[model samples]
Target: MKHQSTGESLSTYSPLLLFICFLISLPISAQDEPKISVGGALRFNYNLSSWKEGQKNRGGDFGYDMFRVNFNARFKGVYLNAEYRLYSDAFGGGVLKQGWMGYKFSDIDEIQIGLTQVPFGIQQYNSHNWFFNLTYYVGLEDDHDMGLKYIHAGEKFEYHLAFFKGAEELNFGSETESSTSRYSYDVVGRNKEINQFNGKFVYKFGDKAANRLGVSAQYGSLYNLDTKENGDHYGLAAHYEFSQDRWNVKAQALTASHNPKNAAGENRDVLKFGAYGAPYQVAADFNLYSLAVSRNIPVNLGPVSNLEFYNDFGYMQKQKSQFTDSYMNVTGVLVTAGQVYTYIDYAAGYNHSWLGGNFKDDFAAGNPDAKWEARFNINIGYYF
Candidate 1:
């Protein structure tokens, strides 16, 4: 499948099912006891696209995007954090984005076990726009997996180290689960990610400017079910953020390589990554970079209190001579009013997934005459 947006059937689990079930509990009243709170959001989306001629001609669709539940609890040194999402059945129904239980060792140290965000690249996000940067499409940004994570924060530095056993499998059936229908991209169809190690260190400098610089590195094993052997992949990144007053700027440079021991007669130059009910191919070796800038402005329009104007750009350069490069540009504004937030973006992509590329060759095979695709989108949500 070329770049697409959708989801499919989810699998059943055994123990983790029970654990997540335990995590999904009733929202109790807020009191002065051990801290516990439950909150969530209701989101809707509307989009007009240049790629979807039929949809654009007939007018874009406006509908419910998702409903989520977030739960957090803490007692003494033990704490729990989890989020579950419910999407339209066409988008794979319900899935757990993240759920983890952890213990605090000290004021600056803690450990988290279960599904957690990988310690790679920028901490929370790499872009100001909702679509994020190009790194996100290939599982480099905001990616999460089943792992044990250690975090430490000092006066001038922050450290994150993690060891992931593999991707989270929630199926109880006998069939090998399709890696599609997930929130983050991962090796699928005969390969799975496993035995990964990640480390990231950030230094805070220029107290007057609130600047941060960080480096991230990760190496992991890719296990092929058919081959019964391990391939390997690694990623390295350097990122920076500079913030002052109402302005924030971010920049990142990263490179990644994946060598999968696919079954005989399979191509090694391209690998399939599946997520959100679709699979797309990407060059096995490539470098990516992104830059984003935003300015937060206080506004007074009815209940609206804040507005942010931003532009985010990303480019991917493939190492192979036969493959084509990809680039994306998003110019957007965000509006916040009370508990409501909205994003309006004009996103353009060339030889990119989720933009207009066919599933097989968008990021792998070259297309010198690749046409640019654009999408105008608006997403609004109410958080409680």
Candidate 2:
């Protein structure tokens, strides 16, 4: 009887011992994995431009431009990343793009804490790929906000969750302000601010023939606004590549809800679309051609490492309840060597409107029939 009882006791405690061993091995295994490394890049741009009629106004010419500096350190299961940006003559001269700490659990799970990029779009995950010659404007503006996130990845699916200050800067506007002033303040963060929650999910398929397709969705909500409004957005993309070739193709579609209190502040249903294809290695030094249309184009450059040129353009039609239509045209050049990149851009645009309509009466109050504008910008950046 005593021998049988002892045998049972041993069997019960054996599993516990095994679990303890596994726990003890975890840190040792992680330590043995690898030591961390630190590295980063600096990008600089300079823009020189003269704007005429029928173009958007970007303000100023021949200035300090913009500068971006990044620093990153990564090791076995932990990492730290940060970015500092300087805009020529814009507000918030020195701002943090991403300052965060991340922990990796195997290859499938990750957790990040601090002021970091909101994981709401593909651009958020792959923003470092400047080598690609594609252009996109419907991207999440990098706003550093306090947040915690959980990321899980599998063969076919991935997801992210985050919480942050809804607006980059809180706005507390004063009384005696007109509607336009109030509206601008609200959208631009001059009044009370609120906290926001964000989440996203993506899935992919089709592996054969070196082709893949993916779809992603994102949502954000502000909990403290007067009206308690929220914004939602989503994106879909398809990518394909031929085996043993230098040709690749991609297409994407995006949509977002218009919350009047957010930056850019136009409240309208809008649809953004894009498509791209590139075939390199056919020519001597890999010449490339690309064409894109959207609300805005943030960056453009040629295939040269030391010298490059590019352009940005856009056009928008008036909505039924809106009294205005706008268009933009911008072109620029970039030069880079070692770790510094500089850019110069020329831009011109215009906005037109019709008065005495219900839309005008409700919104503009017979302000004006039309407006014209022009602008030029220069920026520089460095990375290490």
Candidate 3:
């Protein structure tokens, strides 16, 4: 589903402008020198997939998942952090993932302002899979926005509170085209003023901090100038995690409601988030559940110092009867040695269950399908 574009085009020099600003703001030191650090990761993947007979063809393919560079500088209690990504056309091209300035009040307390992650669901880094949980696709997890955030970490408790103006705007192509912007568009629309509040609370287990329970919530209000429309959203989530010597288990449940003004229109401004590429108002509410189990194996071979196996499952219940329910399962082994890591995985799903792509076209076409789709992936990455 696509719609008409309504915003002025971005200047071609926007990327260059951001780069110049980042370079011009180097910290000059007099006595106490600032510590500077540079790091990044490069990932490559080979995927083979089986698709439904009526679906477009996807088979063996090789590509780079991400080529990212991170910069960090620290002096006294102040710090600067930024990340730039060189992604494939499939994931969008060059873009800035994060650029933020912050002051560290203590070892576990900090205040940050600029573009950062929204704290409304399970933390992205906690997931065992490379693709992360289904929440990432629906914008409740792993999504970043322009915001002011305050974080506190105390004995037995952790908290993140943030308020966001909106998400970044990076349109790679026309709205009708297959582009990263089409997939990663934040819930807000063009010429919209959105105020978002997010909070996450975590209660820790023991001194080891091996087990924990977390709750998160988000609220958003959007005033769209183009359509003179108003929309609101709310989301809630709870998660639990436990870890022993060699095994770990984590699970999360989430529910969210999106009420766009033109929800029932056949062609309208996109909902931008919720279910993957859901048109405005199709699925007003969504419920998601995810579980992941992982265990470390004892044996090591060659240069591999650690070997871990993991299985992840995700299910989404559609609130509207017309929208099909989705389910996904992924099983993989992660092998790591020094800064190099690899994953050999098998993933399968039904309907539009997986994060790689959307499969709701069949349903929109009035032909419901239950065909099983599968994929085999070998991904390798190196950190420097």
Candidate 4:
């Protein structure tokens, strides 16, 4: 131990050891820089209605109270985005709304994988960062499904494609068959399985009056059913936005067809008695259409920046062989006439139907061939 080793001497050098520690800590300090952000919104609504169907209530009531959370992160060329939503008596008994991950390829193309909203309509593709009337008019029921999607966006053009699980309904087995089975079946097992494919394209005009146009198509199949009974649907939509001002116009149309196996004669009596039986087959075709116009106004307040006023109307028709021709005609309006700090949205609507009355047996009882429903909704949302 007359001469200390070089390693031992270096470890004992206080100044040198301090310098090394500083060098190692520098990179971590840089790497720890903030690279993520978080944001979200909460929405609540109240509805008052007097209808000819079901139950009638006089006082106002909470309609849909929703809470949403979002996260965004990025580093270099990689990015991640996700959202989760909670609904109280809304969104069908509070189910997982949306969860997905995306990858960017250059600035033109991207791919997303997970349980995401299907990009088949203008409303489904709009950014959810703001609270607006787009969600109400664009229609939200059929756009959410489990699948993967590809997107390509350019200066004047954009495209999207998606694949998803199709609509399914529970099918129960007969009492005789259920007795022999070792276990009872739930809704999931009885559901018929299907798959869907969809595509969309958009183009923007570069004229003095800025405007954009879009078109879309879709095809789907039910694997377990025959060709005629399997499900298929298609749709088309368009929009025009004025560049100089805050005005826009949009329209959309969609149709679907299905043919289920005809088990009417064999299962009619058993199904009527509430016993498990094959579903009665019905050949049906459904169609829907919507149109609207909207304008945004400038306001003077803390980011109380914009206000919007809009009116929307839609119609749906379904024809089936099992019953008299069925159709639903509905018209609704939305008005946001005040500043963001103080806003009012009044929605009033009416629906008329044929083939089925407001009550389940209203039509079957031969009481009347037509039924009507009237509703009114008002909501005020604000952020500070």
Candidate 5:
């Protein structure tokens, strides 16, 4: 995973300090009117992997998966939610995953302020596959930013609107470096102007066999500090979700266009993708599609009381005809017994697609000359 690093020391510690202050100032009531809770989850993974001809690293590896701690509190009509995540160098590092406070205007409406998930394509999980999908790789899905969020829900309709400062912790100094490419698509290595906006609307039907259709869009401006130039990013998406009993399905398609300012000496026509530090120059427009289906089995085996099988397919195409398109396929099984859960995944990449592409840079494995590659992963997790 590549990420854009914030060049200043303040950007690195301000959020953490703010969270600590908020926790310290939290007032506990003696009347027992307020509610508070603490909880967290820990995950571990043991994996055996192989790489393509030009890729680096191979063989079996084992270590910590991730650790996240959360805090929640409610008093009167106000609520506070926060979470902190810790990961090693191999995974990432300590960071604030989400921190937000909201005031309930009514049972069906509320306004929230602070860092939160950018409500766009999918609320949480966007794909059934272990590697997720291409949208995740480019930061179109499951992306988070500092913003003001508003949400309203009714019997048959729901709406989410937000204005964001920019992608969080985006580093502008070394925008093209690979180390800072993980997470959001801060490929331009610039913080966005305050004009970034995200909007989503969904409609529900069919009570028995639940069905939902939604439309989402985002628009933002990126200003690079290095060249003193600005860029533009905008996207539109449509999605459908259906569920009945133990069967569920989800599908989404999106088109995004970017106009990144040419690096000081680069061509203006080429735009960057991926992350700021380690980016790929490509055409200005691209399309992405994802589909997933899963079924739960009632049979219990040993400690595994719940079992599910899922398959996911994803495709990506660039507007430039000569640019090689990419696709991915993932099939996995999940088993859970109480707090302990395990997953077995088989993932394959075609053309320039890189398996595990969402978590790390796979430029080496994504050679145009390479036909395909595959990986098998076993992940175990426990929640409390």
Candidate 6:
């Protein structure tokens, strides 16, 4: 599941970069000044996971996590939002998290085009801890791609429709860029994901529209560089969120199938998914389930305003016969201060790429595991 590496790689950011430049070069009347906002964060991480033998034997390890830059501009009803991040080389290095120029037709209607978040599962996130559920690893959660999105927020409901040409590509078609350096997971190697369509609908009820029930559907075509034949993917998800006073509950059930026209002798049931500077295998078809609940506990500790305690669970059932299912659970608390936030999590999983098993093969044709692996992690960041 490895793509050939090329000595030279090209970037596809020229168009977007040019667009930003155009906005910056636009003449602004003396009477009207543009509103620009700039901010970002610095973060650090410490982890002690049982799966890392050396770390477990030596207590744990701590290191720098990331530094990010945020840029936003507003002129009348038009605006731009962009965030770029720098992580250790061991991670994904420097990458753009999201960059989109948008127009707000009204308070509840808008359109965005660029590398934008795909509307699926939940609105912001389904997990409160640092380590998200299994869905995140499979690219079903918090996934962003190069696309155009339209959002409409009506009084009784809200919906999102998007069409993505492909994943954020760092290398143009001129070269064989093999590095899986990115912020979101997508098909890599000899296969390319293209022509994606997404639609999400949500109905709200209760005071302030605090309760929501939603469903999402997606269809996309996969182009195989080797086979030169077209393949496709389809997905569906049902999600619910309930909020009351200081309590919140979120749940989702999703199923997806991917068929790639790989080269002869290659496994069609497994495809390579890459992100965060690494690549892993995922079963071609699977059903996923996730549930999470949280409670806000007001705290008066010095420099700490409040605390949120929550637990999240994810289960992935492989459709291929005899393939074992994957499971994950996270119990953690989020601490929020004025401009700093921390995530303290105790996470465990079986056949999970990040939680325990082999990084490359755990999600595809996984072997019978001895036991569940656990990890204790703390991630704190300062925001401006």
Best by TM-score: 6
Model 1, CA-based lDDT? 0.84
Residue-level lDDT of model 2, residues 278-329, one tens digit each, is 1010000111112222122233355335444544444333333333444445
Candidate 1 lDDT, 309-348, residue by residue in tens: 9999999999998788999999999999999999999999
**lDDT: worst 10-residue window of model 4:** 178-187
Among all windows of 10 consecutive residues in model 5, the one with the lowest summed lDDT is: 358-367
TM-score of each: 0.89, 0.53, 0.80, 0.62, 0.81, 0.91
Better model by TM-score, 2 or 3? Answer: 3
The list of candidate 1 runs beyond 4 A from truth reads 1-34, 172-178
Task: Give residue 227's lDDT in candidate 3 (0 to 100).
Answer: 51
| Segments of candidate 6 deviating more than 4 angstroms | 1-31, 174-179
For residues 284-382, what per-residue lDDT tens digits would candidate 4 score against the true structure? 344555555666777665555566655554554434333332323223323333432222433332222111234222211212234444444555443
Local distance difference test, candidate 4: 0.43
Q: Which stretches of candidate 4 lie over 4 Å from their true place?
A: 1-34, 52-58, 62-64, 89-91, 125-142, 165-193, 223-244, 260-283, 301-304, 319-372, 382-384
Better of 1 and 6 by TM-score: 6
lDDT of 6 by residue, 105-164 (tens): 678998788999998888678777788778899988888898788899998899999888
Error of 3 at 215 (Å): 1.0
Number of backbone clashes in candidate 5: 16
lDDT of every predicted structure (CA atoms): 0.84, 0.39, 0.68, 0.43, 0.69, 0.86
Question: Residue 377 in model 5: shift from native, Å?
Answer: 0.5
List the candidate numbers ranked by TM-score, top first.
6, 1, 5, 3, 4, 2
Residue 315 in candidate 4, Cα distance off native in Å:
1.4
> Tens-digit lDDT track for model 3 on 1-384?
354564543552344345446434645445388889999999999887775433335447778787889999987556889888777654556777778888766789877777787777667544677666556656666677766788998879999988776566444333322223433335533323257888999998854898879999989865444455667888899998888898888899999777666534433322433223332222447788999899998666777888899998887777766666666788899989789989888887666434334543321221245665777888899989
